[model samples]
Target: MRIGLLTEGGYPYARGEARLWCDRLVRGLGQHEFRLYALSRDREQERAGWVDLPAQVTQVRTAPLWTAEVDGTWYGRRARRRFAQHYGDLAAGLCAGPAGAPGQGGYSPAEADRFRSALYGLAELAREEGGMVAALRSEEAVRALERVCRAPGAPRAAREARVTDLLLVGAHLEQALRPLSLDWYEEGELGSVDLCHAAAGGLAALPGLLARHFHGVPLVVTEYGVPLRAHYLGSADAPPAVRALLAAFHGRLAAEVYRSAAVLTPGNTHVRRWQERCGADRSKVRTVYPGMSAARFAGAGERPGGRAGAAGAGAEPGTLVWVGRIEPSKDLVTLLHAFAAVRQRVPGARLCVAGSAPDPEGAAYLLHCEELAGRLFPGDPPVEFVEMGGPAAPGLADVYARGAVIVLSSVVEGFPVSVVEAMFSGRATVSTDVGAVVEVVGGTGLVVPPRDPRALAEACVALLGDPERRDRLGAAARARAMELFTVEQNVAAFHRIYLEVAGRCPARRIAEADAAAPRPFAVPAELRVAGAGSVEVTR
Candidate 1:
């Protein structure tokens, strides 16, 4: 089967959130022919170029989400009217809010129908007129937004949105809708694929939605981290009006994607809950944990004195290791304070932060953590910051091997991949009780409350003081990882899901010429001729 793998700022791009998992999926399922439809988030990402693709990848189509290009093709008067009608409905739907409540001034069914029609109408216009960037940024777009916000049943927050808020929302919507104008939707492109697999939700799933609408292609959306959650987190500081509009837009899109998807695969239960709230059918949702490569950690269970243990001498007897991208959400400050408390009780304890900062902000945060460590600990049993450089960095398994306990202090988490990696390396863990951390850790690790340094410190100390308990927990952690989080398991789960979804979809009928007909079997004339030539042909 030919699969259309849709992604935004991932796979093919050297750096992005979901690149590694998507690459693994494509390579793991080599039986299917894949065509990548990627959306680049920035100029640097495009300049970085793509990762090496497998031979099974048939083609790749990409569009930039960061750059804006004008589409000058003029729409006839009739087309303009259609655009107004459809665009009006879309804007009105957004303005009325996503929850279909009468008291919330939500749109009625008739109004929602108008929004859907207007949205498709504008999409049709963009298809004919090349693109909608220029039009979407025009004053007409502002007026349209204003008209909807001031509509009879519009939400209070939306009605209060200023001109600037409308422009910002409009600009974002235009870029998100840019996929509609791309030529990838024709019969020769996405329409030809047997399945459409969206790597994440939001704009990445837009093409998949279009494919499902334009053709009868089945869509399977896989979200390791829910995009709507990220949108909500990121918009926390935005103006109320802007937040309201964007939230409504994202909520509606998520609902549509959930409603149309044949199957929804979330990496963990946390994301599954998010999908459920967005109207996904519980029967259609499956939780497939993200897979991790465990080959490097094969010797993790070996004793420190064994030949396979490289960190035999360097690893402190009671040290703790935290491996992840250094960021505020990781709650390094809490971890640092926790370590300080751990030091007073367990004087021999050390904390190794093994990972690089993902961004400038994270780098700064790392610096702050380093400063805090110096002030709090005053040089005894210090907090060691380890930078894992690309290729040259120490393997993650080795990092895990250097510690008796692994720690995760994240305040918010989706599917903590680092925690799974630690588990694969046979390290006992102490993690915050947030997101899917507890679910992934199960009974293998000690759980503590987030943002509470005392609880984190006590948990770490408990693991550090009990060597036998640590060993038992570590063994159980590794067993859990092998049973659930290995790449093979992930691949098998997806393979089954693909088959299940495809089975529900109507089967495609191939013409006689297009089908690979079996070759007719024939008996050799020599065989029929009895002892002709005494038989054997030598190579």
Candidate 2:
């Protein structure tokens, strides 16, 4: 089987979970060939270069989503008319109110069809012409957007859109729709792949949608975090009109992607619910947990009853561990206050905050946390901050081994990777009830409500005081992690899913003999299992 793996931002290039998981997926499924279709987030990511490719990776193609290049494809009179009509319909769809005032970002079937038709129509136009680069950013496009925004039945926020708002929305749409202009849909490229598995939804899945549109390829969309939810969370500061327009656009796009995909693989029930709310078919949705390696935590898991200080991993009997990226969303300040309460009860209790700051905002938040810790615990603060990879920073295994209990204080989280890691390391955990924290912990650890220092501190104190309970939870967590979240399980689930999707789709091969035909796969053949015999590449 040949797979066209689609991704955006962190993968192959950027050093993060995206890169790790994708690399693991390809390496684990060595029997299948992979073709990477990556969209880089910025120059920094592209400059970072790619990881070593395995022999099974037949090809790699990357494009930039951060910058737009003018392809100078001037449209003639007829082309200009086609562009205006399609662009008008698309903009109008964005401005239309949801059925029965279902509120912003809500799906209305009639308008969904309009948006879907206009999107593919624009894609078809881009294919006919060289690209939609200039036209998408043209004065005419802005005018079309403004015209739709002012139309009779447009949403109130959209109707209030100013000229500046139109330009901002238009510029964003141009970058997003740039995928439609890519030359990857040709017969010998994506058309030839047996399956197209998107590493994410939203922009990452756009190419796969085009492949399904142009050829008969099947698409599988996997989302660890729903992109629409991210957009809503991140766009809080944008102007009302701009926010409304973008939200509706993303919501409609997600709906169309869900409607078209052969399968939807969400990393947890949290993400699965988001997909369903946005119009995903429940029958087509599968929950596949992200895979992690237990080898690094093997020694830690084996010594669940061992004291961290005894092993020189840097923790006392009452030390609590917090591990993850340093950001405002992590709610570290609350963790500090919680620790203060824990210290009052346990007397010798301490907290160790260990993680890296991915951005400047996070760095500032880390400083605030440090100051808060100083104020709360005064001289010789028991709260320690350790940057990942620093000289004093503990190794991954040591990080868990050092703590009597692992703590997660995030007000917002998605598939809490650290919780799984802690579980693999055989450590009892205390995580806030956010995102997939409760789902991932699977009753193996204590969970508290977010923003409640009292609850968080109580949970930590309980675990610290009861060594037997901690050991039991730790052992159970390790068992659960091994059974459900290991690399072998993740890879096997996907392998089976791949075969199931392939079996359900029509069996055909894109024959080179009729390469010029509009429908590339004009030939048919019987579908065979991967090892049974030679199987033709058909989506």
Best by lDDT: 2
In terms of TM-score, how similar is model 1 to the real structure?
0.90
- What TM-scores do the predictions have? 0.90, 0.93
lDDT at position 223, candidate 1:
93
Task: List model 2 lDDT by residue over 1-539, tens digit each.
Answer: 77899999867785533688888899998888788999988898888888998998889999999998899899999999999999999999998877742322365777887898899999999998979999999999999999999989888999898889999999999999999988999878898887899999999999999999998799998898889999999899999999999998998888888888999999999999888888788889989989889889877776545422122123358889999989999999899989999999999888889999979999999999998898998888898898897777679888788888999999999999999988888888999999998888988999999999999999998888888788788878888889999989989888878878877886555565545653322223224457656655443
What local lDDT score does residue 278 receive in model 2, on the 0 to 100 scale?
80
Count of backbone clashes, every candidate in sequence:
2, 0
Clashing pairs in 1: 86-118, 89-115
Worst 10 residues of 2 by lDDT: 306-315
For residue 16, give model 1's deviation from the true position in Å.
0.7
